[model samples]
Target: MDSDDLGLFGPGSVTWKVHEEPILIVAGLRSLYLQSLHPRAMAGVAQNSNYRSDAWGRLVRTATYVGTTIYGTTAEAEAAGLRVRRRHARLRATDLFTGEEFRVDDPELLRWVHVTEVESFLDTARRAGLPLTADEIDGYYTEQRRSAALVGLDPATVPGTAAEVADYYRRIRPELRMTREAAETALFLTAPPIPWKLSLPARIGLNLGPPRWAYFGIAGTALALLPAWARRMYGGLGLPTTALSADLSVRALRLTLATLPRRWREGPLQQAAKERAARLAGTPA
Candidate 1:
């Protein structure tokens, strides 16, 4: 089904159309954040072999991650019209094993979302003062154009205009909340491995990074409660930078808890996680 069919663009209601909601902004942020944590999610685009280096790879990686996580399958991601190609550079289409011609860049809703997500990622990274070069930024946009064309956009209607992009977001940002199941699944999926007990293979994976719980709350209530303090702790403790699952998990738990209004710490997600932890530890939650 088309994004329009899903009430993404907000059917004919001015209030829905005119307002730019936090859900959409958060959607963009969440897509980028998840991609940063799961760079391998972009396996299709990054490993395309056809388009090698430049911003295209980064954008593709970001888009691929968003597609896999949000849609739950690679084939579905492809069917949703997610792919990348170059504009004014070179052709980079690949042939599937079934001998079908595949173009990664099209102007479909998926590509638009991908581009927006990638742009948001770059913007956030830039804000964080990461060590990316200008060449990288140019490469990202080049890839962006390729990705846009993969879906069906005629290059002309690529929403190159800022107002146009903003207008589009104004229409599509409200219906993006996480379902309870989705929230829980995402919470777990994004978490780092718990070392409660594991086999050699599992331990090997755990050794690759710190446990997820260590980083989960850095940006949520913990951040809000003690902004500078949290930053200092992350800096001084030298916590694992790759443990985003934990950081996001903590944020999700805190936000979920905060939704209770009266008793902040004893919310649904908090209770659930605590209960799970207790069961695992053989103690009361």
Candidate 2:
């Protein structure tokens, strides 16, 4: 397919159904927490990312890149992927524990980031009551290989089924660890600085109380929603989340967020994608 054709995945794809939901805010946090378990990946981020000083900015940028790749036109998605690749080419980092140097674009590191993010998104949406079937879950992973390819990973090498994902995790577990950098990244993920605009209202709402407490609550809940094995990696920090509690919390949060009007909940890119789909189907947009 041409890069200028309709984006990678179409409207009926599982990716659209999952990515369109608001619960992905939680998924994003979960992905970051999971990604930090890899020492080299954490070291690269600590050395190169401005996550501490401009956490929200970094998040917005990451969200934009994801949104573009998922919802933008094929040309746009490819362009965005090229930009990321260009940036990665110039970046390098040393493993904090092993004192080994590696490029940011190393395929192994890229695969780690890709699997964690897609798995997080799928898991969060499923728990939040998105109503995906077993087949759809597998299809979602298969579809995401296009996304992997965009970032320079060979699709054949990326996991494209639930079973493959499980096996990938098993093979990679030996390399995962809770390094000091990972712990600090976890802390930062839990309570990064609130944006100035949000901080002003938060200050007024509770008489200058740190708004981070509210975020901590949400992050704690997100952490609880993680799979048991993933949560156990953090040892005592996992917050004692049971499957029942996680299910209830996710459902409640999904319902609450659903109350917002469509215009408020849907981003411009998603809205545009819907309209384009409608037009393609010869229906009212």
Candidate 3:
């Protein structure tokens, strides 16, 4: 049965190579930072997401969905996508800026989320010193259309190349803003409370140690890597070398993480997928 399922992205795909990096968490955070800049997008997340009240649970669920889509069997990936589509179809939010109602699953909004997400991942991977050429980077964007489709977007309408993505962002930039909701989201991300799901002792530990440092480091890196225009919206006309410093910091972070034991860093979904792939190849994982 394992042999029959390689998930949405097999081990050979650039998506797998990129998403498996321990540093993708920074990329994920960066996506949140970027996506929140869109007023309607921020409104949808603010209205429906439980990150404020159940931050840990929300994190786990989002991770599960992403892992399942990338590493679970093909059926698992499709099932996860179906669950997302159904959930989205039932949710609506008021656009505070426009005083209008908008569906969470609106293709335009979905497109915004998809682009920010894939772009952040690519950007973070590159900055973290991943050895990717321009062609491979573009290929990564093309490969992400499968992910965009999972959330009810038409793959044909989604940007499939790096140039297309940049052009899309250019066309959409005028609509982006730092709404109150966006600013609040950024503040919460910078210093999120310890996940309530942890034991009291665990929460206390998280508040004081490397766990805390890691989270802040990632948050800071995300903020540092924001485009200059984004920084201006957030009230900083950043220094000329902001981009260069962000790149250096990411490279340092990646090197630090590479020293950790693989078993301690790899998530179960990723490990399991690798095991399945090995089994299919008659080799050990």
Whole-model Cα lDDT of every candidate shown, in order: 0.37, 0.87, 0.87
Clashing pairs counted in every model: 19, 0, 0
Stretches of candidate 2 off by over 4 Å are 1-5, 201-211, 237-241
Q: Name the better of 1 and 2 by lDDT.
A: 2
Scored against the true structure, residue 135 in model 3 reaches a CA lDDT of: 88
TM-score of 1: 0.33
In model 2, what is the error at residue 154, expressed in angstroms?
0.2
User: lDDT of candidate 3?
Assistant: 0.87
Q: Which model, 1 or 2, shows the larger TM-score?
A: 2
Write the residue-wise lDDT of candidate 2 on 1-285 in tens digits: 332244888788999999879989989998999999998989889999888999888889999999999988999899999999999989999987778889999999999999999999999899899998889999999999999999999999999999999999999989998889999989878877777987787667655454565577679878787767778888744444476687788788899999999998988878787788887787986
Off by over 4 Å in 3: 196-214
Q: What is the C-alpha RMSD of each candidate to the true structure, in Å?
A: 21.4, 2.4, 2.1
Candidate 3 per-residue lDDT over residues 140-251, each given as its tens digit: 9998899988989999999998899989989999999888888999999888887645447674554457777877877988988887788788887677688788899999
Write the residue-wise lDDT of candidate 1 on 21-87 in tens digits.
2122233334433322221222223335333223344444544444332322224434444433233
